[model samples]
Target: MRGAKSAKWVVGAVIVALAATACGGDNKDDKPTGAGKAGGTFSLGLVEPVSIDPVNAQESEGILVTDNLFTGLYEPTADGKVIPALATSKTVSDDGKTWTFKIKPGTKFTNGEIVNAEAFIRGWTRLAAKASASDVATPNVGGIDGFEALQKGTATTFSGLTAPDENTLQVKLTTPDFEFDVKTTHTSMSPVPKVAGAGKNQAYNDAPIGNGPFKMSGKWEHNKSITLVRNDDYGLTKAHLDTVKISILNSANAAQLEYQGFQSGQFDWARMPTAQLTSAKAKYTAQNEWIQADTSGMNYLLPITENGPLKTAKARQAISYAIDRDAIIAGVFQGMQTKSTTILPPSFKDVYQKDLCVSCIKQDKDKAKSLAAEAGLKPGDELHIGFNTGGGHEEWVQAVVQQIKDVLGLNVKMDAKPFKELLAAQQAPGATGAYRFAWGADYPTPDNFLFPLLDSKSINKDASGKVQGDNRGRYNNPAFDALVEKARSTKDSAARNEVYKQAEKLAMDDQALIPLWNRTQFRLVNTKKFTGGAMDFHEDPNLAEISAK
Candidate 1:
């Protein structure tokens, strides 16, 4: 999932402090710049790239930029319900195998290309075509009928998809999927102009043509910074902002920027630095709004290689038992985390299993040592671990390595590499050993958590012919896979939950991956400058409703 998970809640906590600091402004008049202004510019500092292309993007920062510059057929509501965006309404067959959508009228791309039935066909077909090399397309559309066949080069046509008119599009599925609407909100479903850019993937990166409220003005240094000007041709007049500027700011310097007021009144909103939460609260007292919500995301220490000393199930369980997750939360996050018992967070009320705790791998140094010995590991076995300094809980990573070294009596080496390099290494097949990374919900479903992270088949050869991205660990268990598949195919929610519960138990017992904690979503917006309800899914500052005080 491309949403912020761990940092969202922490950011929300800081927002609360910001809200306390700044008070008494009506929510309506909190926008930093008055609506309809054309000259002033608002700058946003992001921890990652503000990439224009949706295919190669991975983080929420990039998605935020996409959301502002792109429009999809559907979007998710605050309650996790799907609502129309480019499409007016959709109808599903009683058996749930067929879906038909009525496209919204009078929509036009920024290039003045009138959106029609052909546009929908062209966009989806392009995404479905492996020749496009679209990363977002393959995963999101793989569930549709003939999609897999198309990707495998056995099919020339997408059997599941059809567009009969400029205003209507239809999809025929092989089986019933209850989460179809939720899936449609993904970026893969976003419409793009057919002749907007050249070269397969270069077009989206260089110039994006979407029927959104904003149009890409320019991109600098391959998405380090991006510029977007208001799409004056847009049909919606409610979008008050004239332009938006996004700048890439490393997490380390985010605090300094916020503390220095570089973004305070000049820009409407910016991520509050973790170290400045308290001080920001005191400084912006009564002029800010901070909110926190469970993001349904998990951060874990994943073991990459399922061979060697850590390959045995018992050995993995022992390693899990040795680390103190509570200490990591307190010391690293400053009490900003909830201990996770399972892969799915409690926010997913229906599918999150509360009863199953088969391998409640709590802190037990002695037990871990015994299990390691049982796996035939000598006292001097070398265990190598790695993490990324580019994103997430650096302190936690250091503390985990220390705990493993001290408790296991093993020689341990830890490598903290750059974020991008670490991501590349993690995606490389046959890479022995695991690293720490945060998993955010792509959608608000337990299937999102289990299928992508644990499924054996999710691994695939990237452009370089190396197995990459999800399923990097290459950990596989037939029992676990069966349970997940059963859960997916079964329509009965209760039955699916039961199967998922079993899957969770098996994952825990086998120690497939260590469950760290469910992260909280956090946003600190200066209420004096901007006002709107915060979103748990993404930081979507609704500009239409905001005004300058």
Candidate 2:
């Protein structure tokens, strides 16, 4: 039921295609080309469908397209620094509860809609609307003043948000959030066409309007293809290519397509399969292609539920010890993954605790049995585990389940359902089931990693009036919640680090979740053709400066 914060690597050191195109003739010059000079069409492959609305899109590929199609009020720099995009400058109140932004002049949407303070207000308000069901805004912006109240039917409007003038916008929060600038990088906070925000329907979905580098030219849903043309009217800057096409494909077939050259010039770039890493290196290296290993951006795991046999701390710890992560990473993952000690990846500097727990680093079969015995579990006790097979990766899930059965004496039952159904079941209160899930950092903050999954306040009822199932296991500890909240409010690095240190300890002690391998970002690209901007979790396949050689 866990949503991917960004993208995933299909293989080791095999680069995922950001965008690619083949030209009729090769140009050996290494110089950059002018806008629209690279006239050929580029085709990028995505594993998942781009069904989510652009305003609330969460997938990495979706974000890449959205970035080219829209511009946010602010954009994150390469080093995770925030700089102005739509807004020229911003001022903060002495109390730190209010922020005033000065809108940049001459900013306009692709549909000729003027970019003003009112546009920002309208866009954010629409995102916070209950009808939107926007995953991006619900969890991130709910903390803003009057936002949660509106969602709960206690308030009719966002009293904290005000647009007093055409170019002046003010935002009031319930409390000061030091990471407000970082939070703005999310798509929910990005400005959208005022018309598209009117209602959720085909008009909004079919005709997405934005002020980005590219605009949607055509879409073929059944064929899984989207055509994007350069937004010539975009005032900021022009794109190098005239058109870019994105095609959705099965993960298993992506690498094969690249190797066969079926779409050779059309599919100049692709993510090489991990199984073919040795062959790819031998083949592509001779051609002088770029191949590198990028760190997996987040931690992936199968969380144990509190209402199940894993309710006991010993049982939960025992489950963690039962499966050998090294074997899973080597055999199932082909050494493309790294064992994670902390919930956060090593790429995240401020929040990741390097020395949290050394003993839990490796799996020990004897230790797992001893812990299960301590939990007072007799023979024949059933352990029910759930996983989403429709989202893909059924093989990995089956392997993990088999390993657990072989190592632990407990009887295990597996339920593999479609992602949507499994997600719904996971969120249903009193629904005790363990499932495979992964968490990617929304923003580069410890609070981002700790809050949504663990915080007690995050739990709520769905549209059906049933208890909303964020904390699927009903695992609640006020002390842990308080520690996370403290970290969220503090601006000091040392104070926030100390709070996260304590919070990590509490989470590990309860054994509510298992720490798995940290993911690495991998993408295959024709370096000779396109150039500029390094890839990162925040922005994959930096489209801003990419071009055809």
Candidate 3:
């Protein structure tokens, strides 16, 4: 696949915190049958999702809801493969610029509308339309031919798309992107009504239509709960659970509360909050039911570029080399996560190349001080660090501050801003000092992991050319960018891996970002009642595969 050309990125936020756990067996009027049985109910905990609209929702909190509510053209397997879902089969043309898909027979949305090629075409067209206002969505879909023009209002419709008949969908691309299947994992192709309504319809956002195994039973109650019932006509895999309830507990201590709720038998699945990990580990370990997997996103740090010492890569490397990742893991995360050296998560065993980051694997106070001095930094320099509004950042803030002070003799000032304000501040020219970076998979490919967030092409500019895209720090290097572009355009798996490894080394050598740790999902399922719940590498829980034990 010709890979990501996306300098412009789209909708989504990484899931930041873990869930809470509690203990007890609460009474219920009905008990579900064992795993593999035909019917039962399952409940899980969540922080509030921003939107249930498949095209608009970006964060994982919203994905959990949307994944259940709709099925995309392709389904991601737990191991990182993209296979057909709504699509019966897909084939690429000789030139690799066109793709044709065969829709599964008899697929229909909850509204009883046929999920034909036109349905798919309309969904894609609407997503790229000028009025969608889908900041989180437009970037992902705009890579298609003419979609970008449609979003820019230069074109009324995407000329790249055509549905010659009811069942066949054809797509023409401007470039040869072999990894296009990976992009299909996003829900931008979830077929909509023949005549879609205008922006943000309250009725449409809630109780939305889908062709997935489950259907929304009622309107989504923001920061409260969303209820779902099974679609008996779902054409693919059988939906073992009769119902699913997602409780949105937007409390300051939501993670801790989920701990208590799940232990009380209120939640069928929940995360073991880091706050209670120490206390719950012994008991949960004894039950032999706790699940732990490295959710394939990254927890890293970025340094802003416009004016400061960070403009010099040496200063950034000095900062990266001085930090103590172990202390953060021991103090803040309780030693559950694996150390990260690059943006690629350790879970992609074959794709991630070890030993790619130079002078970053271990803390070296002497080397850090030397590098800082070379970058023109003297003692008592006040370093400004920015973070989004939240409670859990205090310990991390304190740790990084103390580390910098001890190693480089620098003073640290922390800036806390609301989420919206933080995003704006980060994008402003030469203003954002330093901030954190967390990226969950928008797709399963390594290119999806490396591009947009780190590429030079993603750097936005005005008429005057000040950097703006998500590469907030403006870390631009020609050699690095070439390697990345080569990796994106290559088709052979071995060639892709070879080029990616080179790009990974080049990126970290420049200290594109200081990789801190791999995300670990502290998963807990009610073993007595629920027996099958698995998360794909993207961390989407497969609802169709879930069942009551």
| Better model by lDDT: candidate 2 vs candidate 3 | 3
- Report every candidate's CA lDDT: 0.61, 0.62, 0.67
lDDT by residue for model 3 (1-549), tens: 000101101112222222211011121213322347768888877766556776566556666666667776876655455667777778887656788888765767878888888887777877767666553433355457997677566887779999877888888887666677667777655777754654366688776788777888888987689988887766555477899888977664556667778899998776665666766767776775565665667777768765676777888888888898878788877886667777676766667776566665788899999999999877888788876543244567678878988999887778866433555566666664577656676667677656656776556443345443456667778897787767756777688888888877777877777787766665566768765665544454556666776
State the lDDT of candidate 2 residue by residue for 114-199, as single tens digits: 87887777777776766665545545676678787766657656778888788888888887666666667565576776677543
Any idea what lDDT model 3 has?
A: 0.67
Instruction: Report how far residue 373 has shifted in candidate 2, in Å.
Output: 3.4
True-structure RMSD for candidate 2: 5.4
Q: lDDT, candidate 1, residue 420?
A: 54
**Looking at candidate 3, what is the lDDT of residue 150?**
74
Give the number of the best model, judged by lDDT.
3
| Candidate 2 segments exceeding 4 Å error | 1-38, 153-156, 219-223, 250-266, 285-288, 291-296, 304-306, 355-359, 376-395, 411-425, 428-431, 463-475, 533-539
Model 3, poorest ten-residue lDDT window?
Answer: 1-10
